[model samples]
Target: MNAVGVDVGGTKIAAGVVTPEGKILDEVRYPTPHSPGTLVETIARAITEVGDAPEVGGVCLAVPGLVLAQENKVVYSPNLRAVEGIPLKDELEPKIGMPLTVENDGNAAAWGEFRFGVGSEADHLVFVTLGTGIGGGVITHGILMRGAQGSGGELGHVTIQATGPRCACGNHGCLEALASGTAIGRRARELAVEHPDSALGRLAARRQILGEDVTELAREGDEVALSVLDEAGRWLGVGLAGFINIFNPEVVAVGGGVMEAEELVLEAARKEVILRARPPSRDLADVKVATLGPKSGVLGAAALARDASSREYLLGG
Candidate 1:
């Protein structure tokens, strides 16, 4: 049997029919709607489109928000404002005519990595997705640690610098503010303005200098761009070092669109982790790039639905 996975992101919503072993059988994507009700309908549409298989057992949604899992509600989502305080599962299940599971997007990605990606063999792992903002998921003894209210894995909001720049979360010096894609873009713009004659500056003058632009320019040996990435990488390393000392996970997988630069970021993070992470724990876990790529969120959601179905079946529901 297959399960349906829906990844509701800030800019887009994606869905896929996933085999039990994590293979995606089919997938579809749509632009995210701005209205709460419309977004829910869009998600349902995506689910229906991808989960057309006769054997699909259940559906799961990976939401980018502070999901109140027990209530199937989205308490808050800075990126997707429409979902705020919405009873998503309640609204969608009847429309879709299936059992539903709701989970935090970071947790979903982590679950995907735990079950089928880079951390498949690890008993303890941490997964961080660094994009427009940072998202986090943690697994210990093969079980997700959602805390009492399902808000446990918010690693991006963790403070890396006490007096650094302000984060979108309204906090000062969060890991997200320092190392996320937004942060990279912001820094690149700043550097470009400071050095108007440089490559980054010339590029910024032509159009908006995005995080991808910074990375590309760095790869082409632009000094200003390299400096921005290096700064972001160091902050990422600091955050990873903190996670290493605290959780002591066996593996840590980092992913997200910003990671397109790959070794440009991970190499710096590893170097800093080696410098700051506590002794044996530092040596215990190997931080690696997430191999699942963009499919992690949907696959994880599918895994969530699959697990829910198995539990219901075992209980004779």
Candidate 2:
């Protein structure tokens, strides 16, 4: 079967026609609009463009915010402020002329990974996307754990340091503040300024050094970059240790732009978790990099549509 999946990010809206096996057939992209109405229209247009084929079953939207699944509204999203409280499902269903499902982008990604990626073998899983900020999703017993308010798995917001750096959410020392890609880049840039003779400095001179640049530089034997990554990895490990203790999931899948330095990042994180987390929980949970990469969000959205349809069929039967 075919479905359209829309990934609504802060900067762009990407929609694709996907097969049941998670292969994308066709995709369309557009810059995200600043206004709520324009944004909805943009999404609708993209969905229509991608889902015009006769075989398309439905459309699924992956949104980066506190998604109220019951009402199909985005309750709170700092990145997409204009869309807060908008009735996304009600608006997009008629526009696309098909059944529709909406879910948190991270949750969609978790389900995607469960259905088609590395987590396919695991019944209980947690997916952490360490991008501009951190996003998380949890799956238990083959079901997505969207809490009562549809905002349960805000893992990044978990406090790592009681009196640490301030976060955008008005919290102290959130995992996002300490270990996210943006945090890693910001720290690398700061260190680059101090170590002008370092390779990191040279990379920064050519262009703004991103988190992946730091990891690549570190692999090439740059001390400053390695130091920064190691520090970030340790912080990530601390957070993951807590997660392991609490949930004891079967697998922890890490993704996002920063994960390009898989070994550099995961090794340090693994070391910390191994040292800190409870023995059996850490051992039982296999930590791996997300195999789906950037396509995860769209694929996850498509998976959401697929799963929803399957449930409907079962219920009707």
Candidate 3:
């Protein structure tokens, strides 16, 4: 049976009806609403629009927040604050007329990669997305490791440097604070002030330096811009090395806007991993770019919905 996956992002919500084989049969996108009532309605609309087929069995929402899996609710989401404290399953299930569940967006993306993307060939995988913030999830022994509170795979919050910049989560020296796209932009702006004649500096003089601008400048061989990415990549590597030691995943898949720089960023991260990560696990992990890109959350959530449907059938039988 097919299932519906809803990716509730900060700016928009995307829902897709996906087959067991991972093909998206139908999809819809809607701008995310900020109000609690409108947010629930928007999500319900997206699901119903995409999941018209009777073959679609269930649904899972991939949301940006600290989700309570058992309760199927979002407890906190800094990026999409309107989703906070909403009992999503309770609100959405009735509207969409299906069994629904909620998952952290990062976990959903990790599952997507494991099931259909770069990590499809690996039983153990680590997934990290470097966007406005750093989000990550882990699949070890073929299962997601959600902690007691359903916040287990929060890789970005780990402190790699005790004295680094502050993160959105208010933590200092967090991997997110150093390696996220937001961090890249912040770093780029800071460096532009030091090298006013550089391309990045010239651009920043006109307007704020975004993460994409940094990548563009680096591609043009701007030294200051390249250095900013190099620093962020090294910090990312520091975080990945710790994950390598703990989970020992076979593949570490990196995704998100920052990764558009590709080798410009990952080359440095790999070098750091080689230096810091220990023997077997370090040597075994293949750090690669995620294949699904922006669609991972939707695909992964659909997979989770399929899993939930199977579990329900077994429980009922």
Candidate 2 has its poorest 10 consecutive residues by lDDT at: 308-317
lDDT of 1 at 61: 92
lDDT of 2 by residue, 168-247 (tens): 78898999999998889989999999998899998888889888788888999999999999999999999999998988
- lDDT of each model, Cα atoms only? 0.91, 0.88, 0.92
The per-residue C-alpha lDDT of model 3 at residue 118 equals 97
Ranked candidates, highest TM-score first: 3, 1, 2
Candidate 3's residue-wise lDDT over 111-208, tens digit each? 99998999989889999999999898999877877899787799889999999998899889999999999999999999999999999999999998
TM-score of each: 0.96, 0.93, 0.97
Off by over 4 Å in 3: 311-317
Which residue pairs does candidate 1 place in steric collision? none
TM-score of 2: 0.93
CA displacement after TM-score superposition, residue 291 of candidate 3 (Å):
0.5
lDDT of 1 by residue, 40-137 (tens): 89999999888778799899899998988899788989999998988887898998988898899999999999888999889889999999999989
Q: After superposition, how far is residue 46 of candidate 2 from its true place, in Å?
A: 0.8
